[model samples]
Target: MSGLRLEPVTFAQACAFVDEQHRHHRAPRGHKFSIGAAQGERLVGVAIVGRPVARHYDTGRALEVTRVATDGTRNACSTLLSAAWRAGRALGYERMITYTRSDEDGASLRAAGWEPVAVRPPRRGWSCPSRPRAGGEVEQVGRTLWQAPGSAQAPS
Candidate 1:
């Protein structure tokens, strides 16, 4: 981990790497930016930031961490989370948020200075005929939303 670096990456590259290494093996759509963590020349992890998928959070100043994928590299997740926040701030976003399934630990997010803000209730699958979605393993699970530290105030 000595030569680890965080750098901007294209959505295609991030999606490819995430599909290979992420547990769910699913790539998110509509990311605004993707950042990668590299160990020397090899990519170890990625974080995808984008507009919030939830309609309630679609404000112009709020962004979301859509995905974080890693190849089991220590500290990669936390590093990518931190870098995502820095990138968002640089781009003038007021708040950054993300969600983790209830059963999943939030150590990486906490290490990146994010705080658990709320626990969202489980939802039924979103597979209506008009808006069919590929069923996901965590689709119906409860999730805990986390926000970057100091973003408690409403986004401007």
Candidate 2:
């Protein structure tokens, strides 16, 4: 992980990486911005941050780390996560959040100073009677929301 460094990434690039490497979720439709973890010239991971998916947390000052995908690189995930909150705080966002499935441990989140805020119940899917939708690969699993604590250094 010594050679790993954060680099500015385009939305398309981040989405592509997630599509190719993520374990479950697909690339998000959009983002406020994207950050990448690179080891020398190869991009090892990406983090996409944008408005919260839950309408309730979509306050103007809130941002969510919608997708984080890594190519099994050591420390890549935690590094990107820490950078995300730094970027969020530098932009004046009051809150930053992300989630991990109930079965997944949040070691990276803990390493980045994020704390668990909720244990969300499992959902059948995103499809509902009111608005039609297709739940992607992994939707039925319950998840835990993790929120970044206080402020941090500016964008990393």
Candidate 3:
């Protein structure tokens, strides 16, 4: 990951990068803003931040890291997480949160100074007769919620 640089990137560019490089190979439905990591001229990773998907977390001061995709570059995920928190704080957000699947190690989030707060149970896929959904692997898995250091705890 030589010459690694972090900079703001548009949603479209970040989505494309993530779709191409992420192991999950899925782009988020939307994002408020994104940060990109570049090794020299090549974009290697991106973190997409936006309002929390859960309505309970829709407080004005909260933001969530919706997706983090990296090209296996060392420290790229940590760099993006740290930068995303800084960017949130700069924009007057009081907290930043993210989730990792239960089976996935959160080493990158921990390295970025985020703390695990809770383990969310697996959710049944959102498939109603009216609004069918294409379930993915993530939906069947539990997740661990993590919050950036110094952020307030989420409301119960």
Q: Give the alpha-carbon lDDT of every model.
A: 0.87, 0.89, 0.88
lDDT, candidate 3, equals 0.88
lDDT of 2 by residue, 38-133 (tens): 998999999999999987788788899999999999999999999999899898998898889999999999988899988999987766788678
Off by over 4 Å in 3: 127-138
**How do the predictions measure up, each by TM-score?**
0.88, 0.89, 0.89
In terms of lDDT, the poorest run of 10 residues in model 3 is: 130-139
Off by over 4 Å in 1: 127-138, 152-156
RMSD of 2: 4.5
Better of 1 and 3 by lDDT: 3
Candidate 1, residues 1-156, lDDT tens digits: the string is 446798778999999988999886388976999999998888999999999887678788889999999988899999999889888888998889999998899999999899998898887765667777896434667899999977746543
Clashes of each: 0, 0, 0
Candidate achieving higher TM-score, 1 or 3:
3
Candidate 3 has a TM-score of: 0.89
* Candidates by TM-score, descending order: 3, 2, 1
Worst 10 residues of 1 by lDDT: 147-156
